[model samples]
Target: MTAPSAIEVQDLVKTYAVRGRPPVRALDGVSFDAPSGAVLGLLGPNGAGKSTTLKILTTLTRPDAGSARVAGVDVVARPAEVRRRIGYVAQRPVTDPMDTGRENLVLAGRLQGLGARAARARADELLERFDLGAAADRLVRTYSGGMARKLDVAVGLAHRPEVLFLDEPTTGLDPHARAEMWAEIERMTHEERMTVVLTTHYLEEADRLAAHLVIVDHGRVVAGGAPSDLKDALRGDTVVVEVADDGATARAGEVASRVTGLREVTTDGRTVRARTSASSAVVLPALLAALDAADVGVASATLARPSLDDVYLSITGRAFEAGAAAETEEVAA
Candidate 1:
């Protein structure tokens, strides 16, 4: 039998009015599912409606149309119920700097409806579990970035919420800290049996941590599936050759198109892209020799199996970095 859905969303549409400007639609008919005890990655570039979707599901922002249910509780009709069943960890730190690590967890537990004794017990439990037992009594302001992030995650779990919303959880962390958070997320899903809904801009993070992926762009889901399946759907190896000059791009594309195994040949600025059913080794020498014969100077060339970025590019008609840069100047209002 199929696993039950921990969260359900359908055609979620949200629009915000901007003063002296036209209203912006942050979400446009977005929908996806997260199975119970699974990690769902919501991936998109900036202003792609990821944050807006999170706000609606967490009951922080209501959608003008469509429906969402968290842990089987309707976000619109029964927001409080949904809140009780889910833990929301925002992009920024929400812990009190003046409070000790243990104190913050205890307070969060109490707020989640635990008794005083129960709250303290949960705090100690989390401190040990999160490897914060050594610094449990230290002020949060005194802790390192990684330690503070771990504490925030602990506080989110103090109430043993059935579903957790992690929004850019490792955005500012170093590689080590990011890996630590990834492990914690895995523990939450496997050992603790909680469903996680993750929203992140880090392609590597989404590729690594999520059991399933739902990619949203321009306020809509463009692709949804397991990461491996999504990559496999693209077929063949990707060959990218960066020419020495932009002038060589068109010539490079034409040259690559004439190669025996290359297909879907396209040019982007100075790079010529193609896919080959054969291994790169089988075609790289021939491709290069042809480019050299045509006097097209090669800057560099790389062959990689289809990556999440490739899948994203095929579906979105642009590179992830390029798309991400598009919304940097505009707020997702």
Candidate 2:
């Protein structure tokens, strides 16, 4: 028989009251299942309820409606038990700046009920595993951003919980630091066999780290599946043609549509786009010839396989960057 799901959320709803204004609906009918030993990404823009969902699952907040289970225990009914079985690393660093990394880890292990000797041993083990052994005795304030973040992850693992929740794990790291963190997380899941639920706004991060991805938008899940599967479902190569103006764009689309294998020919400003199952070489020449016959000036053209960005655009009818900006503005308001 298959092992039980490590995390499950069913039609979760949560609302927050605002002073002198209507309550905001943070989560609406959000649901997904994360199998054991899988890294599940909860992906979305700001204010998409990604954080809210994590809050509920981590037992930091109560859901207004629906049910959730983590490690086979109901969240609402036995929050303490659920908390015991999960490790949470928030978006911001939670390590005390004045404390040494070793101190923080030992304290965390102790709080989780490990004895003094056990906590010290666990702290040293994690320090070595996360490559913090060299600086383990240094104050957290002396650590670099990447080092501090790794320490945060180590603290979360101090108790060795069944499931780990990481909220925007690489949000503030530089590209290099982020890459290092990604490697660490990969080791955590694959080598250590830890189950993880990671919420992140970085599209590439989800594509790189998650075994399964759930894209949430405006308090609901818009799409979900393995990253490759979601992209494959779009089913063709994306051909983008850049033209001089609206007239050229329109003509380009008209010309592109005439190609036998091209589908969904459309125009956005000076850009003309279409999808085709044929190879780019097989379709490019015909498409270029058609545009040339129409006297449409081509600025540039590109052929790419379908990606997570394409899947998001197809389902949401908006680009990921645009949605992210909108969500940020909404949160500010």
Candidate 3:
């Protein structure tokens, strides 16, 4: 039999009011489910209600409408019990610079109701597991950004919660640091069997880490499934043709569409992109020949296996980067 869902959200809605401005609807009937021990990614542009959803799940705030359950407890009805079973690592670092890593962890443990002796043991174990043992005695101020972030995660786990919520855990880390954090997160889920709900703006991070993905836009799920499945559902390779001038793009698209098997021909400036079930070997030659027949100058051409980026473009009719930028601008306004 399948395990019950570790997290379940149904038609969640939330609205925020600002001075002299209309109330903004942050969540509009958002819903998804994640099974136990899975890394579920809430993938979206900035200000797309990803954070708002996280807050509701973690019981930081109540949803204006709908229901949610974490670890089988209703969030609105049993928030205190839900809180006990979950750990939250926010987008910002919460550790105190003046405290050593060990001290910070011990404090977190104590706050979670562990006695002094147990808290110390848990802190030591986590410090070693997260590779912060060498720097355990050093002030958190002296740790690198990666080390500090790891500590932040370790603190969240000090209570040995069943579910962990990570909001943009790798946001500010450098490439190397982000890689290390990813490895640490993998270890947590694989070794400890922890269920993780991760919110991220980084497309590559979600693509690499999530066992299941829920793509949100404008406070609703636009697409969701295993990353590979979502990409596979698009059902074709993508062909991109770059022409010499914007004038050639329309003709290039028209030519590409005429090739049997190619679908969704779209033109952007001097580039034409299409999808085809045929292999690149079969599609490239036919596509090039068709464009050539149309007298469209092909400066370059390439084919790529379907990707999450492509899936986003196809489903949303906008590129991920562009949507992210728009979300950011909306937040600022």
> Which candidate number has the best lDDT?
1
- Which residue pairs of candidate 2 clash? none
| Candidate 1 global lDDT | 0.90
What lDDT score is found at residue 8 in candidate 3? 93
Q: Over the stretch 91-191, how does candidate 2's per-residue lDDT look in tens digits?
A: 78889999999999999999999999999999999999888999999999999988999999988999999999998788788999899889988888898
The clash count for each model shown is 0, 0, 0
By TM-score, the best candidate is 1
A best-first ranking of the candidates according to their TM-score comes to: 1, 3, 2
lDDT of each: 0.90, 0.87, 0.88
| Root-mean-square deviation of Cα positions for candidate 2 versus the true structure, in angstroms | 2.9
Candidate 3 Cα RMSD after full superposition onto the native fold (Å): 2.6
Clashing pairs in 1: none
Error of 2 at 207 (Å): 2.1
| Candidate 3 TM-score, C-alpha based | 0.90
Clash pairs of candidate 3?
none
Candidate 3 regions exceeding 4 Å error are 241-260, 267-272, 289-300, 329-333
TM-score of 1: 0.94
Candidate 3 per-residue lDDT, tens place, 1-333, comes to 876799999999998887898988888999999988879998888878888888889888899999999999999999999989999999888899999999999999999999999999999999988889999999999999899999999989999999999988998899999998899888878998889999887889989989999998888999999999998898888888899877878878877878987888877668787888777689889999888888888899989898887888898777687778777522312
TM-score for each model: 0.94, 0.88, 0.90
